[model samples]
Target: MDESNNNIKEPEKRAFLKGAGLSIAALLVGGLSIERYAVPKDRSVPVMDNFPLAILEDPSGQPVTTSEVIEFAGAKTTTTSSPILVFNYPLQDEPTFLIALKGVKITTPNTPPSSGFAPVPSGTDAPMDGIIYDSTTNTSILAVSGICQHLGCVPPFLDYHPGQSVPFESELIGYKLNGAGVKKWPDYGLIYCKCHGSQYNPVWGGRNLYNNGPAASPAKHSLPQIMLATDSNGYIYAYGINSSNAVIRTHLNFPGGETYGSGVKSEDLTGGTAIRQSTRSLPANLSLYKNTTLESVAPSSLGTNQSSGAIILYKTTVVSNENKNGLNWKGTF
Candidate 1:
């Protein structure tokens, strides 16, 4: 976790408050709506004109580079064994959960056929379902999509403890029930949806037991795994994701089920059914995008707070017109 930078130190911490809402139009170079953007006068980098791109003179725009390493304790601040840590970037839309699993048993750090682990959803034989490491403390980080598939609810990162109601317990973890009406879990690795009790396993990375919930298909709902990269200096960078094109504008879609879709705040209902959900590890997802698309970028320095990595937003599209700050593309539960 080296904080020493080869480059010169930037100015003091800067605050750039990004609008949490996404308009129908993306960030175009000129106006709010991009339908009538001016064509570039110059002929060089023609495709670069396609995106309304912005670059920082310094890391002035980065949000997570501070020295604020969110510690293990939560609202209580007492010692506890909560399974995961959630870093919420309210400014970013769609699938907004940055989860770090606290004590997941890792038989291997490199790849799988992982011992003491279940099968994580992947397209190939070698499944590197998402798992990162704080090698310093041996903690595994799971920066999973918070948007639930059965419905879009930001499930809590909670410890599983019986005989304790969710509200009375200050453990920062939850004890939500599954489809089978079971609330007592044998482990603490569940990202339990409060809306409809859609339970997803971060331990196995992108594992969904639809039989455990009321998802239409067998294991249809899966948490979207985020892509992350880290320099030897302990900087974890999130650049991409493998998620469903499914749009969930409201969480009321599947009410009364193991999970329900209800409007998080004032989000309008957008139309798109989830095809499937699966979790792929950061390394695996990165490889999939790279191998298939063969994209590359020259190296450049990004200013970061060093506490967390600012999300590297590669793409975003407005899906619903319900509110001024409409929802962006989201994953199925």
Candidate 2:
């Protein structure tokens, strides 16, 4: 076998942080006793009535222009509670141009974007970032956070041949199991974690085996995904996401904990028939809203079929709340 043919892609470098004794529970938005369920608002356009809506004005208090996009990573850095940012206005310092972002992915970009952008290390707490290059549209500037949602570990990106076979050891690029039962060699994605033997997918969104890893179901849920999008001007925006969801939350508990009811934090009970107690760190139980009912009997009996006789049903198909254990509440919405 040729040595060149044996070259394997390395796993993306990941960061890790100690989270013991910390209240990892999610902050219930707007503060309410029981979680309230509501249909999501349209995110296609600006529907939020909150402050800091418009991009912060530039010094000398002038708006940004197109030429400015070429400078300082495009328009003014936007901050919002909605998680997604945009750059639709023109820069005051440069040529006039428009920039807009839809959801997390950049559906549009202006001019030819950069070919390849490097990751800028902002700070210890600053989320890891990356850039995307799109040739089809002639735009390539993009950025995203690189922290892993599973236990606050960072993911290391491995560069490998796109369409070639590689060695398992050379390809070993992530945390793997070692010692009695702990993480060791947090390098070389081996689909094994030294800390807990938690297997991870090598190709983005890969599968995880071993205990302490996300369960197998809708395999897509195995990997944490970063939200990304670009504006009409070519600047990219990326966001981080938690991996736990309704389906996966169950796997989050210690084998002896309570099985019924949904939530994140669990109490460790060593007794027989032990029940797992949960803390506020988990998502609320599955909630259902009445969306369907028996059609009007009058229509059938009276032989007068009308649109009112039909019933509709609305259920939560799937939700990954991100905060706490997102996997705690999977099922029919």
Candidate 3:
């Protein structure tokens, strides 16, 4: 995406030489107090060990500057419900698409995640243009690959109801690993691939086969989550993609073969080094990756009557992120 980092005049690149110290595929449990009580499952984000200083590069392989906000604002021509738009990023193959899920409700916690980006949904309608700075529900824009995870086929966005739109193979029946890396089935209506009926979460991490697809396939069941970053001026950047339970299907000829069982563990096909499982992740962790830098922005209302921190008023889809204790921490490192 050819975005201009014009909104916020940044000072300079804030780089760290050392750990400054501490960090995702699923939280590095070596440290950090793992709360034993029944906390909100989304809060159990993976705290990586490495710093989030990764360089964010666009598809052209150019270093993404803070001014990239210009492009993000330009991409949204109109605020259509669940509009599927593209942000040319990573350039690994193609630009990532930021699909807007109009009505699906997700959980939004009271406080911002210490990491910044968490699976919190503002539960508000997405702006036609520009990123919605939501400190509350946290998720408003979900960036993902337009390609289907089944066989890299480009899929169509369908209406959830049958007959009016394309019919699904059946009621979505599938399961995926949650933040805790536990497998369970979840239903994210409407956003399903017409190509193979592979349903996924239109928001958050863009899970693959949250309902099982095909007779039986293998892998961590994840679609690539386009890593999203926002600037101080309410700009959303598609810098990279995130994938999990990485595996390479080399020999489909021998699906049951012993050698085929232990396929290759490939690194992410994204341009950015840092990875986040879902929006519930601490956005700050992304800054720890090298090559890129992110300065957290407070929630800013888009071009709406509602004011800052008042997103709840204009909310159409409210994703609740309630903590077990029901307290709002300052939510910072």
1 or 2, which is superior by lDDT? 1
Top model by TM-score, which number? 1
* For model 1, the run of ten residues with the poorest summed lDDT: 49-58
Q: Backbone clashes per model, in order? A: 22, 67, 49
TM-score of each: 0.41, 0.23, 0.36
| Candidate 1 lDDT over residue span 291-314, tens digit each | 223232321222212223421222
Supply the TM-score for candidate 1. 0.41
Task: For residues 20-124, write the lDDT of model 3, one tens digit per residue.
Answer: 121110124433321111111222232221112123333333333333322332233321123233332232112244544333233322332333123335545
Q: Cα deviation of 314 in candidate 3 (Å)?
A: 33
275: Cα error in model 1, Å: 25
Alpha-carbon local distance difference test for all models: 0.30, 0.20, 0.29
Which of 2 and 3 is ahead in TM-score? 3
